[model samples]
Target: MQENKTSFSQRLTLLKQKEVKQTLVGILHGVERESLRINPDGGLAQTPHQAALGSALTHDFITTDFSESLLEFITPPEVSIDKTIGQLTDVHKFVLENIGEERLWSMSMPCFIESDDNIPIANYGSSNVGRMKSLYRVGLKNRYGSMMQAISGVHFNFSLPEAFWQEWLAKLGQEANKDTISAAYFALIRNYRRYCWIIPYLYGASPALCGSFIKGKLTSFEFSKIGKGTYYLPYATSLRMSDLGYTNSAQSGLNICYNQVDTYIDSLRKAISQPSVDYQRFNGKKDGQYQQLNGNVLQIENELYSPIRPKQPTRSLEKPTDALDDRGVNYIEVRALDVNPFSQIGIEANQFYFLDVFLLYCVTKPSEFFDSHLYQETETNLSEVVNRGREPNLHLTHKGESISLVDWALSLFSDLAEVAAELDEANNTNQYSAAVEVEKQKVLDPSLTPSARILKILLENNEDNGSFGLNLADTYKKQLLATDYQFMTADDLTAHAGRSVQKQLLVEQQDMQTFDEFLRSYFESSTELEQV
Candidate 1:
């Protein structure tokens, strides 16, 4: 177990590398309306009312479970393993047919880096806290390719029970580590996923909830109608952060390939099919493009669109048609993950296969990477990707070298083929090879990626979509909808203000409070929950 200290940043980084944790990669998949889709001609399709409501895809389902649970529960039963290939496609098809289902789901895979082969590790949750944001932005990191955390720097989840937390951690967990975190810990998900972009590791759980829910004791029962777990658990993972920088660089000449996978999406969108009668396609025609998505793999890519909004020019704008450049990626949102809607496994097997290749590609390249250089080349390439990631013979860069996306993907597919074969040897007689090959073909043919098909959908729907930025009005609306969550919502803020004015009414009644009295009365009360 890792010990805690008072220094905030120092302790946070250290905690990420703890040993008694069961940490694994978390793949989040969310869904809602495509209010922000643009037409093939590059025009918006969002209406005024919808834009005001917000355009980013909203989530209707959310779940997180241990990695072990995933292979145990979500995997096909012993008798069904042989048919997993075609049947798995049916799962993808089910999802595609319900694009605007207004739900969010997630699964966890029990995975550790090949490097962590012999190490018994811990999962420390993470976060930048109040000052975390500026550090990442002003400085550069992630050069090792593995150094940078995927999505949020502090990435993790938990598997706690609602009743258990109500009886313990929420009341005394943080108090036990008061000298370190200087706060109480609740076992729930709040102000995260949607707000407070930063997540911290407390017990190697998906950002083990860190704050005492003093008033609300959900001891009897608690659950999201769509989520799998009754409550969250403590995060418990550790990290290996180092200071050496500049390991390698993309070279002038290398045999790299760059193939966009856009075309694949188009083909799938035009030909989906599902065995479930409720979602089966109409007449098996391409006209119902969604049918194509049936059983098609779900590769989610959530991204922040800057809209070319630059901060006020430091020295004033030069003034020209170049005033606004296209927005670059703030962070890529990878969705398409299926929530063990029925359970809380981090992610599915097929999902992990794609994620491995994708993340590995993002972090490791022949050439060295820096925050600055990546922004310069990647932003340009991203446009082409969003525009045509699935196009056959697409181009890409590796180790500072260029290659065709088709050939590059083909090469990767070959590697995956070997991996599938290897996995088959270890498990069910290599029966899963065909199942894995399915997506490889999807990538090669350039007709299975979503961004590729969305082009036509936006065009057919007359794509003149719009979006909103951290809007006050919109945020307030979300507050209204989620009556329970808060880090001080606008309404709570006012209540807090009023409460402060009347602080004298508190039990202390003393101008200066005493530490001993405060500790006993508040934290060490005889409540069954607060037993430190």
Candidate 2:
């Protein structure tokens, strides 16, 4: 570990050189924020996705997640974090204006859901790809239950500039190429897996959830009750990322490798190709209707859950892994963030700044190759932080040694502060250092963390999770609606919706093959990675 620290320090010194420092200026980022649309009464809205918001299948900025009520807002990749966030905010403003009486739920957990049957699956229109998209969600509902599928999150997509990669290759006396770039990303992923618990520790906000989410289900957690229908863990951070939410038992045996791109792609390929006995009982179809894309461990590569993923932009009709196999990692998507209820956009600018610094640090640090034992250690650490991050004297394992979470976090921040300072210099702004400082306070005083703040608000008001979230929903709606668009106009957004509707129609018209053929071809194309 001391040797690794020395390597990181040497790399940081190299990055601080004038010639290499300017290469950091173009770091790109994007955001994908998901929220549920709720009625005035705080019940999940049963209405179909609004036509005015455009086709969920074709829209570039707005779409639905699992259920029709679960809206996802996307911003295109931008070099400027401020512009990226501004675009996200503009999209939220447009969505709020167009959704009529429905308010976007503020928390990562869903609002009051009556039952699984009440949550309508998203409809993506009549194209073969569209039907495939909807069917994928159907499979998710069948496998994970609609309640778990209703949970929301914020995905942060990040990538350093090409110039930085070139500089990095030069520093290592290696050729600038896809393999080298991809290897660097995988190394970053390994380090990210080791320390990602910090994300939940600082930003996790789902300490409590409405009881409706787990109405008749059995849970291992010893939850205490709050005001009417709210269940909570007193020191919990993100129950949304816990076993109660996105974390599940189905993929526990995967053991997917992240040490290299080839092994990673191969693992995903095997999962999709391998049939699951439990899922096989569904027989892939039911009474002449397609039950799922297939009865495999994963219907597609996207089904494999992870806190972070190496990504490449997919071509039309191409699978995610195939794109990576063909061109290497284009960026990385951080999937661990819970939707911040306090922000109208579901994320904040300072959070983006902090993520930039953390991700850069992950890349700069020396990462040891992972084995199954080390991988499981990372998993256990993340689970500990997700469930009981704010508990006094909490401990997590690091390099097979148990350490106080606060102590580990403060040590990490010391390194993060250096990376943050370099980023501030490159970007010509102090936001990155400021962001790290703010998060450092959360590490020292757990009460300053988002989860603690949320619990404090709920406990003070004697409010159920649903009631508290609804209040925030109302507040954000008013605030967003009153604020003028920063990066887009009402006319621009309306035109985008109009264009998406037309694109959806065009896709439907262009479909020449049956849905069966389309599904088969999609699976067949996924196998190309194995051949590669």
Candidate 3:
């Protein structure tokens, strides 16, 4: 452990040199936030994706996820965290102003869903690619049920700028090339997997949920009940990230390797191609309508359930793995964040600052290659943190030794503080270190964590999760609607909406092949990379 610490410190010191430090300013960040639209009564909205908001298939910043009511707001990559948050806020403001009589659900978990069928699958219009996109969601619904698909979260996209990569390559005495850069990212991923439990520990907010979420299902958790069918775990942090949410039993045995880009792409490709006995009953089609894209372990690479993923901007009609296979990793997406209910925009600027520091720490630290045992340990640690992170005296395995969660977190914070300081120095602002310090307080006092605060608010008010979330949704909705747009004008959004509709129509008109032909061509093109 001492040797590892020394190596990490040495590398960090090297990166903190003036030449390398200047490049750090260019690190880019973006966010994709998902939220369900709910009616005035707090029930999941049954309306289709708002047409005035723009085509779900062609919009650059707004779209639907699995459900038609599940709105996904995207922000373009920006070097400044404040600008990124501002852009996200502008998008939210535009959406709220357009969608009448509905509020965006404030929590990561869904609102009062009565049954699986109550959730409507997203529709993406008649273009081949668009239809295929909706069908993929159909596949998700058939495989995992719509209740699970209704859950929402935030995805953080991060990439180091080319200037930083150039400096980093020189610092490590490695060639400046795509492969080397990708290899460095994999090392960062390995470290991230080991310590990422701290994210949910600090920011996880779904400690309690409406019982409607699991209405007809049986769960093993010994849950405590609140007003009128709210279920909660007293010490839980993020039940949204637990086995109850966003998990795949079917892919539980998949051993996707992050040791190299090749291994990762190959594993996802195989998963998409491999047949599944469990999904075969769907037969891919029913009553002459396609029920799913295919009867495979995964219909496509996007179906793979993971907390983090290497990502590349895909070309039109290109598969994600194909893009990675062709160009290596461009950035990484962190998908474990629960929506911050307290924030009107579903995320806060300080969270981005803290993540910037933590991710830099992941890259600076020396990482060991993951073997099966180490991977299993990471899984165990994450499971422990998500389920019972706030429990006093909770111990997690660290390199085969049991360490108290608070102790381990404080140790990590010591290292994070150094990285945060370096980031603050690079950016000429104290926000990074301030963010780290704020998170450190949560580590010391679990009651300060978002998850604990959420449960406390619910219990103290004698309210159920549904009522608490509804109140927040209503509050945020009014606040967003009343606020003026900062980054985008209402007229600008309207013009973008008009352009997106035209783009969708052009795509539909340009389609020369039938849906069957399009699917066949897509699969053929996707698998042709196997020959390469």
lDDT string, candidate 1, 1-532, tens digits: 1222233233222222322011112212211111111222212212111111111111111111111011111112112222332333332222222222221112111111122112111111121110112122111111112212211111211121223223322222332322212111110111011111101111111211111210133232121111211122111111111011111222112211111111212322222211323323221335422121122111110011121111111111111111111211111223222122111122234543443333222211112212334433543343333323444566766435677756655675564455444334433354446655655655554334322232233335433111111121133223324443222233433343345334313322432534334323432331111000
True-structure RMSD for candidate 1: 25.7
Give every collision pair in model 2.
none
Candidate 2 lDDT score at position 503: 97
**lDDT for position 310 in model 1:** 15
TM-score of 1: 0.27
Q: Against the hidden true structure, what lDDT does model 1 obtain?
A: 0.24
CA error at residue 353 for candidate 3, angstroms: 0.6
Q: Flag regions of model 2 displaced more than 4 Å.
A: 1-6, 527-532
lDDT of each: 0.24, 0.89, 0.88
lDDT of 2 by residue, 176-237 (tens): 68888898899899999999999999999999999999999999999999898899999899
Q: lDDT score, residue 417, model 3?
A: 96
Q: Rank the candidates by lDDT, best first.
A: 2, 3, 1
Question: What is the per-residue lDDT of model 3 for residues 1-532, given as tens digits with 9 covering 90 to 100?
Answer: 1113338868988888998899899999999999999998999999999889998888889988898999999988999888898889999989989889899999999999989899998888998878888777778888888998898999999999888888877887777688888887888888899999999999899999889988878889989999998999999999999989988888877788877888888877888889999998876577888888778888777788888999888777667887887888899999889999889888998899999999989889988777888888888999999999999999999888999999999999999999999899999999999999999999888899999999889889879999888999999989988888888889999999999999999989999999999889877776421100
Candidate 3 TM-score, true structure as reference: 0.97
